[model samples]
Target: MHKNAFAIHGDIVWSKNPKELQTVEGGYLIVVDGISKGVYPQIPAEYQGITVVDRTGMLVIPGMSDIHVHAPQYGFRGLGMDLELLDWLNTHTFPEESKYANPEYAWRAYQIFSDDLLHSATTRAVVFGTMHVDATMTLMGKLETTGLKTMVGKVNMDRNSPDYLCEKDAATALEDTKKWLDEVEDSHFENTKPILTPRFTPTCSDELMEGLGKLRAERDLPLQSHLSENLSEIDWVKGLCPWSTCYGQTYEHFGQLAGDQPVIMAHCNWCPDNEVEILKENNVFVAHCPQSNAQLSSGIAPIRHYMDLGMNVGIGTDVAGGATLSMFRAMADAVAVSKLRWRLVDQNLAALSTEEAFYLATVGGGKVFGKVGSFDEGYEVDALVLDDSQIKTPLELTLAERLERYVYLAEEGGRIVEKYVAGRRVL
Candidate 1:
């Protein structure tokens, strides 16, 4: 290997495309200066003296990305599953998020959440924080130490929220957001960045949205927010913004669709064809939360359709809306939900396959971070070393088959043996 390069050997697998899986047994994955050199069957003679870490029995795959997760909501995951979207938020989400106003509470809750995330397979995420600036800073501070690259947004909601959680006004929301951005800038966090979050159309007033859109333009910041995730939510957006043609149009009207930076919209389950076109035209990234959609009884997203349209798509845990932080669960759930959508909702679309789901969890989601989620020479070396030996099988399995089993069956305990972000080991 080169002077500064290191290599790790394993059963390697990564995505070449949404439908393609690239696997290599006994592969040598070379990393130099926190970037992947290449995966080779043998260490080349030109690079003979570098260190090699032997991860012989493990499977190396790209680190998963969760493009949309609520960091504050992580404290209450797996609770309030019986309620639908609006009711669930009212009963559980708003109340839980409101607790973050206390800096101590934010620290305590975020510590646990950050620790769990560090241990999980996700190496990068776009996270949502509560409206409290100090609490959001607290959250980002904890996440920064985990060596995972993340974008955390302090939520902006000036209307249609509980008194405790909503911002006082659009001006206050904008000012607070600017302050948060300024604080984040001053801190100079290595791995954590700030994102503009507008909550959603129902919660953000026209003025708040407009201000946020302008902030996005001026600062050239990325944004994350909910889209047409539920039918009731869509209707609420319709009534909230009568001048807008569709739910997506309301965001477009206020210039929240896309600016200098890309936008990440969670759960485009109910996006109409026009809205779909708008998302495509604007180059918006969709964060598909399959478990959250099923848990909250929101309609399933046409992810296959999005893929067919060449839209940027990624998977998300969605925290409390989704019950787990495991991207493996998200990958499996994506395929399962797509099967339901194919058989019951729309017969014309093909169900997602294992390869497609894996791609969404990896490279597709990594698009937001730029050149991540794969080991395709020069891609950032964020990866996971999976120990799936606990998964017993009677017959021989292909690398793809083993990955499929791990995606569906691996649980929280001891599945990932090691984790790396930018070729630096984090776990």
Candidate 2:
């Protein structure tokens, strides 16, 4: 028998494309040595006797991926919703992140975050850590034990931040970042990797961005940061980069937009046509964070417009800016906010359907990690077995309908009865 091979029998669902969802009820999803062999109506003859973990009457789907989230801000998820982006960062986020400098506090906070993530439906995440190198490393160590593929970034901010939380200068910030990257390189972490993070244009000086861009290219590391999240933030960026045409141009000028590695920019709520073109030209990943947008009054992102333009897109919980770490809630919020945008802001742009939301939560977000978040052949096997018996319904519903209900109604860390990452059961 193949050591890591197994078969799961249940209602298998996955996105064949953004507009199509493939569903196979009463089927077998085969995993051979951590790679999916595709879903079959019956066990193939070659693997007839392989171990079949029966999950009949339940939902078997690809595990979700959170392409953007802040690990240090998880402790204050529901606070500061009343404030806008800039004020909230000063009032709640900065003060909270400053606490991460203490190794013990960081370990405790990251432990809670990691434990919740392990039980949740996410198997992959792109996370943001604070500027403190030791504490960021601690966050990485805690998440490494979850068996989930994660890209953790140590944030760089040399200006426009609280004195307690800000780095001394561009050189100091780059040196500390290099030290963090070196630690990540020397660590024995199997599932955790480092990404370059510049907090944003207002906080990251030109010199710091230039240095980070150079480090990103030299290390061939992926990058993540915020962009055009709020109107005030966009205005601030325009003032900071007076020579740049748009907020996205600030990053583009620094060679931080795209290259050999992926770049994920969160909350492009106010990116204009030119900025959108820049993002598309570079094939940048846009992480649409609806709940965060709503909480901070940051305005709704034109997710449907981005999808229509064939832009790379994904969903993120965004932690403290949002209220919860549940990607399901994020997906639902995406669908809800799109409706409002279509009705009130732009009639030409249509609302996102639950199906499209699911696509963003799965295949779209998985694109960041490459060939992930699908049950297609040759893809890595990351599955979530959900027990929906408690979500009682009197009438029969299609598997898709059941999944839609779960997206909106299922409780995080509770309904996911079994979790698998690369065909290995971690929960």
Candidate 3:
């Protein structure tokens, strides 16, 4: 018998692809050494005697992923919904992030964030930290103890930010970022690493972007940042990078878009045809932060168009702007906003279905972390055992129907009976 082998019996469900949702009622998922072997209706004879973790009436699905979020903003979520992107940043976000310079405050706040995330359905994330190196490291430390896989960025913004929050200059910002990366290397966190983060074109100068680009090449790390999330923000980027054709072009000029390494840009709500082409060409991961866009009055992202264009797409709980960290909420918001976009903005494109949104929440976002968020053979064993008995209706529900309801109605904590990442139970 394989020491690492185990079996989970439940009503299994997972994405075969973006357009297909596979389900097996009364099935068994075979896992060995943190990798999925397959799902079967009957346990194979070879593994018949292995220990079976029974979840007979529960729903077993792939654990969700959060492609983009800000750790510093977790404390202020649901507070600054009235203001748009720029004003909200100055009024609420900048002030809150500046507090992270105090390591004690960072540890306290990040502990809450980490605890909540551990209890939530998100098993993998690409997270953002403020410019303060010690504070960012503090956040990573808290997350490391949670047994979750994450890439945390120590943000860089040398211009167009508050004096208290901004770095002294491009050189200082680059130096600090390098220092943070070195510390992360030394920390030897098993499931956490550093990502390159230039706040955005408005805040990051050309010199800073250039320096960060070099660091990205040298370290071979992934990058994450904002794109055309709002009209005013797009205009701001245009003013900042006058030589570029579009907002994404500025990042492209600095080799920040996906090519050799993965790049995830949050909230491409206003990307024009040219920018879309550039993003598609570079294979950038477009993080659809629908709830954040609505909360800040940013325009709805053309997610349907992006899907049709065959771009890599995922969901994000943009934290303070989004008001929640539930990828379930993010998935629901993605579907709701796409309906509005299809009905009002452009009738030519169709709205996203519940299964499609589930795909975005799982497989699409999982792509960034490499073969995660699915139960396909040889995929990592990131599984969620959900007891949705409370949400179930009197009428019989198929696994697909139950999953859709879980996406919109199911709360975390109690509903999540067992959460596993890489075959090890975390919650």
lDDT per residue, candidate 1, 1-427, as tens digits?
2656888899999998888899999998999988988899999787687898899978999999999899889888999999999999999999999999887899999999999999998999999998999999999999999999999999999999999889999999999999999999999999999999989989999999999988988899999999999999999988989898899998888788767587999999988899999999999999999999999999899999999999999999998899999999999999999999999989999999999999999999999999999998989999899998878879799888888889988873337889999989999
TM-score of each: 0.98, 0.98, 0.98
lDDT of 3: 0.92
Best by the lDDT measure: 1
For candidate 3, lDDT tens digit of each residue in 1-427? 8779999999999998788899999999999999999999999988878889999999999998898999999998999799998999999999999999998899899999999999999999999999999999999999999999999999999999998999999999999998998999899999888899999989999999998888888889899999999999998888888899999999989877745778999999989899999999988999999999999999899898999999999999999899999988999999999999988999998999989999999889988998888998999989999998887468888899888888988773339999999888999
Worst 10 residues of 2 by lDDT: 408-417
How many steric overlaps are in each model, in order?
A: 2, 0, 0
Off by over 4 Å in 2: 1-3, 412-414
For model 2 the TM-score comes to 0.98
Report each candidate's C-alpha RMSD, comma-separated, in the order given.
1.1, 1.2, 1.2
lDDT of each: 0.92, 0.92, 0.92
User: CA shift at 220, candidate 3, in angstroms?
Assistant: 0.5
